[model samples]
Target: MPGESVEYVVVHPDTPVGPVVGLFLLARSLEDAEEIGATVCGRALRTRAELSGFLLLGCEGRLVGPYFDRLLGWAPAGRVMPRPDHDSGNPFLDF
Candidate 1:
């Protein structure tokens, strides 16, 4: 949260309008995080997906969002799917 901090809470687009759930993104540039958040939220809208977190571009870590109860038939994504070029520790991700 220090070092050029940008703290924000973003709700997944799939989430219903009620008290929105939020994900936390911390970055050196608020603009950068905002851009990534917008993309993730937008993709969630189109995919109807639920994610616990996301890895930011040019960052070595990830920003975890809210967790929602899955519908009876829902299938979860890779808990910690890494980009081909990303190399970092994400405890939530299974090796």
Candidate 2:
């Protein structure tokens, strides 16, 4: 029971929207996470709270801006996948 860890709910991407389901926030920099979001076609989402981080995005050309606009108001998506080079435990990523 000691030193136990929890796993996030994992979902594999299927439909174009599938990537949105398993989004997560990085404990690190918004800048680094935003770069990854841009890679997946999502823009960085900012909030009154600590930077909400990256979002899971589909092609904006395919979906209406209003849909994403409203979604962003709610969940404010995070990184869809952690970068392989990222050190999840170290927020500063010093290691």
Candidate 3:
């Protein structure tokens, strides 16, 4: 199960309704992936007061959103993947 990977897309808190812009990461399960996404968004909300809120719009077993679309003109791709030598003590730093 550890070898298996799942891609999850989280909508940006600012645009929870549409335009779907947020972070994405690969994890072993939906829960882990969602937690990581939430953690990142949480930190963003804490440091950047501009953020309206944090929310998990949706998640799937495969990648989603306009990650590779040139016409969409979305921000540069920012994908978080687990490091081989990641520290289990700190999940946030695993990426």
Per-prediction tally of clashes = 0, 0, 0
| Candidate number that wins on lDDT, 2 or 3 | 3
Worst 10 residues of 1 by lDDT: 77-86
Q: Give the winner by TM-score.
A: 3
lDDT of model 2, residue 8: 34
Highest-lDDT candidate: 3
Residue 37 miss distance in model 3 (angstroms): 0.7
| Per-model TM-score versus the true fold | 0.32, 0.20, 0.37
lDDT (Cα, tens digit) per residue for candidate 3, span 1-95:
24324243345435546545444556766677766666655556677766666444553334454554533454334433434433556434432
* C-alpha lDDT values of all predictions: 0.44, 0.37, 0.50
Alpha carbon deviation, residue 53, candidate 1 (Å): 22
Give a tens-digit lDDT track for model 2, residues 73-94.
4442432233343346643323
Worst 10 residues of 3 by lDDT: 1-10
Q: How far does residue 89 in candidate 3 sit from its true spot (Å)?
A: 29
Candidate 1 lDDT over residue span 57-91, tens digit each: 23223433344233322544432323322255533
Model 3, position 92: C-alpha lDDT score: 49
